[model samples]
Target: MSTYLPVSGWCYMTNDLMKEIIRVAVEAGERIMKIYEGDIRIEHKEDSSPLTEADRRSHEHIVSELKKITPEIPVLSEESADISWQKRKSWGKYWLVDPLDGTKEFIKKNGEFTVNIALIKENALAAGVVVIPAQKLIYRADINNGAFRRNYDGAETKLTADNNLNTDNLKIVGSRSHQSELMQTFVSNFENYEIVAAGSSLKFCLLAEGKADVYPRFGPTSEWDTAAGQCVLECAGGVVLDNAGNKLQYNTKDSVLNPYFIGMREYNEAVLSWFKALN
Candidate 1:
């Protein structure tokens, strides 16, 4: 593997490197699945989120493998995110990972959890790989390359977002665990839309593959939670926008928490106006 310099852009993300990252994510997912099948023990984080042995095992495996693959680049995983802002502020390029997203759903045995890994270049998502362990699905994307969905059998399909937005009957995807009043208000604006409830980063994959048209996230989320999925959606001709209607970015602040954002198959001015009117 070639050593990548901490450059300003995504020039270092080659197809081979993307493949290696995908392999790492898939292996991490395999580790998680082993725990998922057995008697599970769950712990609670200080923030009250569910933590499991699978998260720890996956985090350790991914961090160790990523170091071997790109020793020069730094990695920041949700499991080991104790690095100070002073240290993180200077990182022009780094790996952002969420070993197990939708842990609540994982505990529910709903098969909606995911492993998310993303490359951040100059505070923007350069590449990402998301693996659904139970479903044996992979979604990957890069800044230059388009998005793809790969099956366990190695069959791959190029993903394209459904750019058409039907106001009368929209296909909207929402969080299965974190529904809030703000999200309700946003959805209420559309009189005839159907809800497509999903957990973790699968909502983004749904938009990437044209299965859903929009995802309105009104509740709180961390940077790791959205980065990989956002990359996949954006590379598939979609947009994940912050409240200000700008592209959602990463690592630009002290907190890892993300602001309220919307994920759509494509940029729609009317939708933006509707979201803005809510505020």
Candidate 2:
């Protein structure tokens, strides 16, 4: 609903939206870890998704801080995003966020939950930040600039991937929590790739870090679920596309549920052709 990215306040690249997002998430994580440390009851939404007080706390904290820090930019958060397509279609730039990305892991107390934040422009994810609240680690990227991981030692390391990421052992990324039979068949179909399982938005982080190559998701996912991760993944030299091999767009469709998709590193015509053949 806004066109202020060009004339906006913060310089997205140098301004460190990553830092801001991480800061907010870490602050929210403080609250989440508090409840998580206790015997808090986890509730389930209508879709049977596990919900908890941590989710609401994180959502409220993220939304409040994002609005105050980057008030000029429109935001779509998984918890409170309801802007109509008519209004969002007019937007050239907006923030796509998932305040609590892994509620299931939160319920499972596996410490795999994360915070996801991304900026979108012209249907492309421009920048993203993913933070694991439990471990207090972060991975961030601004498109074409570079991707970075901030470990527990507070050291920031730049991420790099070999050009032949798809060639070697052929790392395949799949959801650590939820996996479908079809998804398994798809992975089983690939003889050259080694399958690896991960949870939450961290699957995309694996692709971003060159730890994995291909991520195929057959189940339903919301736009907020993948937007932030896709930004970091693509920035780190990867591609996340629908079965049609098209870049995923946010807020353009009436249903927020995303179709099946794949995440591949060093993408090219051959990979695109393979994806096309699957469709």
Candidate 3:
């Protein structure tokens, strides 16, 4: 297999490097599982969200491996101490990571959490990988390169987002942790939709693979929460657009919080029209 991919106007990343990222993600997942399967201790951050040993182990392992792989590229991880915007704004290319994306799901043992890693080039997502630790599934993609899914059995399949607009039975994915009345009201616009409650970046992965049609997140999400999954989904022909129908961009502002957005396999005119009316 070739190690190099030509990405004009951006630093090229080798296939070997991508594979190493996948390997690192899997190893982090293993570390998370070891903590998941044992007696667990939980702590809380300033935000009052649950933090466990699994999250710390995974974060430490992933950050260490990424630094080893690309020491020149700075990393912004969920577990890392917050860097000042002045420093972050100076970075031309860097890694955005959430070592354990769904800590709530991890604590609940629902097997829905994921490890997210994204390459950000000049405020745009360049490449990404999402790892489902419990399932041993890995999804990845890069700019101009198509998306793929690797199953637990080691079989790989190219991924594509569903382009058909079937209004009769729309499948909408909603957040398991951050559900709110506003989101429910937004989802009510779909007349014949079924809500699929999901956690973390897996919602985007599901849309990328045609398992779900749309995901509307009206609640809070940081840049690291969505950047990796966005790359995979976008490469698979999906779109993650904010309420204004603009593509979700990263690192454009000092704050890492993301605006409410929808992940869609195919653009639905009716939904957008309604979304515009409401927003």
Q: What is the C-alpha lDDT of each candidate?
A: 0.89, 0.77, 0.85
**Residue 51 C-alpha lDDT in model 2:** 81
Evaluate model 1: give its lDDT. Answer: 0.89
Error of 1 at 63 (Å): 0.3
Of the candidates shown, which would achieve the greatest TM-score relative to the real structure? 1
What's the CA RMSD for each of the models? 2.2, 3.6, 2.8
* lDDT for each residue of candidate 2 in 58-165, tens digit (9 for 90 to 100): 889888887877777788888876788878888888888888898888877888888888878777777788888888888888875778889646888887653575
Q: Which model, 2 or 3, shows the larger lDDT?
A: 3
lDDT tens string, model 1, 86-129? 99999988999999999988998999999999999889988999
Q: Is candidate 1 or candidate 3 better by lDDT?
A: 1
Candidate 2 collision pairs: 176-198
**Candidate number with greatest lDDT:** 1
List ranges where model 1 is wrong by over 4 Å: 1-9, 176-178
Residue 262 in candidate 3, Cα distance off native in Å: 0.7
Sorted on TM-score, best first, the list reads 1, 3, 2
User: Which of 1 and 3 is the better model by TM-score?
Assistant: 1
Assess candidate 1 and give its TM-score to the true structure: 0.95
Model 1: weakest 10-residue lDDT segment is 1-10
Candidate 2 regions exceeding 4 Å error are 1-11, 166-168, 175-179, 268-274
